[model samples]
Target: MRNEKKKSFYQEFEVFSKRTATSPFQHQFCLLAPNEEVAMVMAQENFMRREPVADIWVVNRKHIRTLHPEEKRMLARIDNKDYRTTKGYGYLRKKWRQYEQKMLDEKEILSWGGDKK
Candidate 1:
């Protein structure tokens, strides 16, 4: 049948685009195309015509990997990274003050490479 023939030739593709070079790519929509080239052309014509696009990505749906609910739960658990943050080391400030010395925090350390007068 005509429907069966078209289904065999077309593949589902997901389109993603970004407004600026530094901006992250966001999902625009999905469409069926015969190949990546056709998908890209179709995506630009359908989605990018109305807005500015810095980049375009056309990925076949089958090639995209996704995490299931169980896998997502594993990644969502608290990661015990508090020690890398200032709040976890708040007591250090008081300790340094007791010694009559200033504590070099993250911001101060990052400014070491900046211009100095």
Candidate 2:
């Protein structure tokens, strides 16, 4: 005989919420509940009683799929490309100094945007 009561007790529910208008739904934690109604009620006082929660969702864990540990290992790469940044243009500083001119680096360029008419 299938134990319906035991099956319902161990159901894993994933909790999520959106903090604000611009924010995406983020996973807060997991809980065990039989159905969405119970999970939704428990999620409030259980996880976000003291904080602001604009929205919430309770989803069965079995409904979600995620990547494996081995799949994440394929994202590694070496950082040998210094030529893509200002660090690669350090020689320009010395050349500008030889011509009696200040090196107009990032700081000087960004400051130009301050309080313009």
Q: What number of clashing residue pairs does each candidate have, in the order they appear?
A: 0, 0
Q: List the residue pairs that clash in candidate 1.
A: none
What lDDT is reached at residue 2 by model 2? 61
Q: What digit string (tens of lDDT, one per residue) describes model 1 on residues 1-117?
A: 999999989999999999999999999899999999999999999988899999999999999999999898888648688888889999987887865544446557778889877
Question: All models: lDDT?
Answer: 0.90, 0.82
Across 6-91, the per-residue lDDT of candidate 2 in tens digits comes to: 88577899999888867899999998887888888889878677688788888989999877899777766566777888899999
The list of candidate 2 runs beyond 4 A from truth reads 1-8, 69-117
Q: Residue 51 of candidate 2: its Cα lDDT?
A: 80
Give TM-scores for every candidate, taking all chains together and pairing residue i with residue i. Answer: 0.59, 0.52
Best candidate according to TM-score: 1
